[model samples]
Target: MEFKNAKEARQKIREGMWTKPTPGLAYGYTQANLVVLPYKYALDFFIFCQRNTKPCPILDVCEPGKYTPIVTAPTGDIRSDIPKYRIYKNGNLVEEVTDIKKYWSEDLVSFLLGCSFTFEKALEDANIPIRHIEENKNVPMYITNIECKPAGMFNGPMVVSMRPMPKDLVQKAIDVTSRFPQVHGAPIHYGDPKKIGIEDINKPDFGDSVTIKEGEVPVFWACGVTPQAAIMRVKPDFVITHSPGHMFITDIKENDLALF
Candidate 1:
């Protein structure tokens, strides 16, 4: 189904019409990663994002117990607007739900983090091929040897999303993405996934793998999923996050976040 705007897309998700990974939907609008935590852990997590801007760039944060993202999408409800949500208890993923209204609490806080998906439209506009989008699959993501700066009880390896493109377009891809710092600007690593601790490019820690065509090299970008890695290591009592590749579409436009 094609959506004319972010609001229409989010409404469909809220009504259970779309229950898959969101990549090409709401073209030109921003897409965000979600992290819902208890109020007690909010400050520390916010600081963690501040220290690791590439992977955890803040888009909009809801007040404790609030589900609406007043800044990014005022009409959207974080609990129901996302296609899928992961529920974690003691850091273990316990359930994947379409909506989190049942888990709502007065003590929980919602954070919207910039997603790489937001910059994909720009990449496509520049004639850069996005493999997973072409294959109708989720973007491949992996945990790396790169450790994030520790913040309070949160500290873990950075997670990255990979896209393989023609070797010649690597520099152009970097230039296109570098303009959007809020959506993980630029490629962190363009070749040799092993150098970043990825044992096998085919087996990603999250999301799905796509074809790496001949003459193409895999490029990696800091992923918003990094917080989920920290949540797993820290084993917080309870938390909620958007399922990998399932993001919340926002009313904000892509160019609004670009440097130029």
Candidate 2:
């Protein structure tokens, strides 16, 4: 769990020394959602993310065939930086691999999208409890009734990640996260799971469901997984994305990403 910097952490991933969720790894740096698509679909997906900034805040995009994410992590290789990747063929998950070098090609474009983990430190500093981290589990995420605006062939329901916190700290969590718009900022919905089309809060579509205590309310934030949901519906020929909680750690510091 200890790394000198984002690059070093990524090196560990590249070497296959680390193959797990990257929440507590590379502390103080930003973690990003990875999306790799064919050159033909790049423009549409880019526009799709632009249209739905709440769930798909874009941080950087790599040109076709390029693996180096110059804007987010200049020296990092997108092919192996993330601990795990989900390979989708015609919208169905076909493989989950640690290294994607075999799938690398000149027709692929990589995107690094902002993640909510950028604001975890701020919330902890404010004394707000993050139940998932406390329990050493992945943040719970759900596919919702909220639909994303269509951009070309990409369109699907907006996905959200939930965090259970005490009622008293909800406002503080909102305030802390709102300062970082580059990350998914603020809670989109809170209190009721059925309101968002989540039939059972105890069971989540993605990631592990954590305990919701007596005084706690489940706060939902727009998730980076929205893009993956879109791909699932669109049925693209080939797509690469980080597994739900396995993100690509970036060189950018969290403080540099905050708005105020």
Candidate with maximal lDDT: 1
Candidate 2 off by > 4 Å: none
TM-score for each candidate, following the candidate numbering: 0.99, 0.98
RMSD of each: 0.5, 0.8
* Tens-digit lDDT string for candidate 2 (1-260): 68988989999999999897877777778999999999999999999999999999999999999999999999899988888999999999999999899999999999999998778878888898878889988989999999999999999999999999888888999899998888899989999899999999999999998999998999999999999999899899999999999999999999998888
Best by TM-score: 1
For model 2, the local distance difference test gives: 0.92
Model 2 clash pairs are none
| Native-referenced Cα lDDT, model 1 | 0.97
Worst 10 residues of 1 by lDDT: 181-190
Q: Poorest 10 consecutive residues of model 2 by lDDT?
A: 20-29
lDDT of 1 by residue, 1-260 (tens): 99999999999999999999999999899999999999999999999999999999999999999999999999999999999999999999999999999999999999999999999999999999999999999999999999999999999999999999999999999999999999999989989999999999999999998999999999999999999999999999999999999999999999999999
